[model samples]
Every structure is written in structure tokens, then in C-alpha cells.
Target chain A: MLILECPCCGVSGEETEFHAGGEAHLKRHSVGSTDDQFEEYLFMRENPHGVHFERWRHNNGCGKWFHAARCTTTLEVFGTYCAQTYEPPKEIKDAISARRPGWSWRNFS
Target chain B: MFEAVSALQGASFNAGIAEVRELGLRGMITLRGDLTDKKLIKAVKGIAGRIPEPRTVALKDDDGAAWMSPDELLLMVPHADVLSTIETLNASLKGTHFLAANVSDARAVFEVFGPHAREVMAKLAPVDFSPDAFKMGMFRRSRLAQVPAAFWMNEEDAFTVVCFRSVAEYMFDLLSIAAQAGSEVDAL
Candidate 1:
């Protein structure tokens, strides 16, 4: 069982308590945008091999959704943060950088 | 023309009552607010005898407040006190952005006790139920038999399990089977 720590409740429980909500920090291309842009918004997703960020809901636990920064290959959770924010915190990014040097994800380095 | 009945009212289980029993008609309320607010803390402390914290259960008078999340609590009282409890919480925490609602009928409550209680719970959930890990006053929200449920370790050998009313019967059945002697499994 994959253990996940809920930032809201502060409980680190099994994956069964959480629901993966796909990629995190996506820019929404909306109404006035071109069809290609809208399609990218709806269909494009990053399948990263190393450092990645994703959204997950602690549906069975605190019932709060949060962001998880993890390594895709090794499943090492760099950190977890509240989902209310638009981007992962700078310290979390720095931690990732310290572990995996010179790695870039989207706008973050 | 009708009255509400418990999920296991007429059902029978082979296991002894000392190990487990249905705690019917509990007054349950889902309370949401800012825990850090001084007024909110004092208000909840007035109601449940102490400020509730995440993963812990606090008792006030005869009521017990089980922590549901960072901003949510499950307050359990006698069935008759349900309405008044909501009113008290609202009155005490006025002006703050808070929500207090009675959900007494939405779920069923079961009390598990005696020597084999931990073994029974182990069969169904993945929670840490050992003495050092899951102690009295600690609560956990997780799945039991693939159904959403929450359980509180209320004492040394006692715990409370609450599940949706619709699936209460199934939950009771699963608990009964798990309660059988020697049907034990390891829980983390």
C-alpha cells in the first residue's frame, strides 16, 4: 500500500485513503483561446520520468484535496502542500533541485 | 406512522455482545470552522469540554467530539440532544464563518470492545491499530471493506465504528464475520 501524508489532517496513511487527481499546476486555456490551445488544455498532460507534481484527494481521510511533489520513477515524495495555492511552494521546488540537480518542470527550475 | 430503527435491530450475530454491539440512535453533527479562531476554539471547548484536534477525540460531559479533519469535527451526543447541540454551537460561534449541522440519521454507530476487538478491526481496515500506534482518543477515517468509514479508539479495548446508513448492514455483517474467534489478521 502506498502511504500518503495528508497536509490538512497531518496523517500519513495508505494510498487507499487517497484518490489521485492527475497532473497538477496546469494553465487553463479558455473561451477566447484557439481550438489548439483549448485542446491542449483539455488533453495535454505531462508524463514525466523524474520529478513531478500531482494532485490527490484525501477523500477517505480529511476529505481535502492537496498537491504532492514526488519522483515519478522512484515514487519518492519530495513533499506535500495544500491545494488552495496555484503552484508548489518555492521551498518544495528547492528541495527537488537539491535532490535532482538542474531539473526543470514547467516554469519552475 | 413509523419510527426509525437501527441497522442491526433484528439481526443476530454469533459473536458475543462483549466483543461488539450496535450503538443506536447516536446524535451526530458535522461541524466545520476555523480551528485557530479563539472564539471557535472556546465555543467548541464549551460544547465538547475541550478544543478538538486532528485525529483525536475530546470528551465534554457525555458528548465526544471526534476530529474529522483540520477544519471538521464529528460531535456525538445523545440522540435527543442533536438539535440543541447544533443550536448551541451556532449561538456560541456566531459572527464566525462556521457550519454546524445535525447528521444523526445519516450514519450508524457500532462499539467494538473486549479482547478480540483489535483482531476484528484488523480484518477490515489498513489503519494502525496497535496499542502504541493507535491509542485511546485517536480517530481515523478510512475504508472498511471498500466502503468509506471512520473508527475511533475510545479506550484501551474499545472503539467506535461509524459508516453510512445505507451500508450499515453490510458493515455489520463484515464486522460479525471478522469478530469470530481466531479470525485474526495483522494490521499496521
Candidate 2:
């Protein structure tokens, strides 16, 4: 029942219209990386109960992939942005921090 | 002489509330590039009347353009004019990174006409079909039931839907079922 808006085409649709792409902004470990780093890269994932960032595709709409910042507890969406960036934009981070103080996710706080 | 044939061979259905008719063959071009590029805009304007704004359509008679994405546009023209339109686009946008392909055969089009046309569309797609929300010239790309589809309102009582040709029968069935008699949701 989650209603998400595609930032690319500015169309809002139901969750059924989109495909969830799991976690977002994962760093890849290249060929020369250590076993621990590669294992962490492949296996480790953040399962935060509060604020989280994830990837979603507007599969039925514009067919563009975008990032969404939301809360796992209340299903409150902080914002959605284009997926072309390496990290969540500062405005989205600030918006999340404003609502949930002392919140930190990986390298972004 | 090669005879062109549509996927559904001109299917039509009357469900009391609306009339669903296959639009036969239509010329469609998938153009991808920078929408703001001057040459690209001019080339597309020549064919579709004008470049559509995001989530909108620019229509002039049988020719129109629907905004598919930030970098893509779906141009509609007469079936016989697809090849020539592509050639014109290629010549207009030479040396620029762009793509224009004939997708006329890849899609099936249907028109739903009646006073309750929006009701039929509202039953399947998860879109705001309220008169205030989905006005004329507004194009939407979304799923109709379980398959991918796109639609736009040509008039208050008419809607045009497009889906892959492989699912033309399915789309026709979906529309006909949604338009069945005594199944109106009069909410929007």
C-alpha cells in the first residue's frame, strides 16, 4: 500500500506498480580485494529498524530506477531521489536527521 | 506487395458502458536522446507537433508525442509514414548521440469510447483518473492489471491505450471486462 513517486517522470503510483531493488549504495569489492572485504561486500547488509535507504524501480511507469529514504517502523518516506548519485543528497539526509535525531546509516549520518 | 496486419486483426467489443476497438496499425517511433537538444527538439516537433512536457502528450490530429521518460519520447504518426519519419529524424540529428526506431509493429493500440470511459480505465490502472487529476493531453505509463501499459485521454469520453502487440488480446479482454454492464464504480 506504499504510494511512491518517481522523481524522474514525476508520476506517483502504488507499490504494486514498482519493483523493490533491496538495499542501495553498496560499494563493490574488486578482484584484488581481501577475502573479508569481499565477503562483507557480498553478504553484509544493514537491517535498520528505523531510517533506511533503498532502491526502487518504476517498473510499470517510467522504467527508471530511483532511491527512496524511508522508515522501516512506520513506513514514513523521507524522500525519493534519482539513482545517479553515489550517496543520498544532503537535503534528504538533513530531512531524515531533522525527523530522527542521531540517525546514522553506514557512512552517511 | 507486402500487406500489413495488426496483432488482433481489428478486434472490437461493446460492454454497454464503453466500446473497445483496436486501432489497427499505427506508426510509433522510440526516440531516445537529450530532450533539450535543439536539433532533437526540432526534429521531433516536425513529426509530433511539439515536445511534450513530463508525463504529458502533445497531439495534433493523428500525430502526437508522449513523454516516455526523461530521455525518451514515443512519437505517433500514420502507419505508412514511420520509415520516412525515421529517415527525417536521422538526417536531422546526424552526428549526435540519439536513437530513433520504428516500434509500430511492436505495439497494439485500442480506443475506449463512451461517457464512462474513465471508469473502465480506473478499474485496472493504479492512477488518479479523477477528471481534475487526469486531464486531456496528460499521458500515463503504468500497468493495466498485471501487464505493462500506457494510456492517454484523447477527449473527455475517449481514451487510447497502448501495450505490446503480444498482449493485444489480453488488453482487449481486460478493457472489455472492466467496461462490463452494471459494474460501474461511479466514484470518479
Top candidate when judged by lDDT against the true structure: 2
lDDT of each: 0.83, 0.93
Q: What TM-scores do the predictions have?
A: 0.91, 0.97
What is candidate 1's CAPRI-style docking category based on DockQ? high
Q: Indicate the worst ten consecutive residues by lDDT in candidate 1 chain B.
A: B9-18
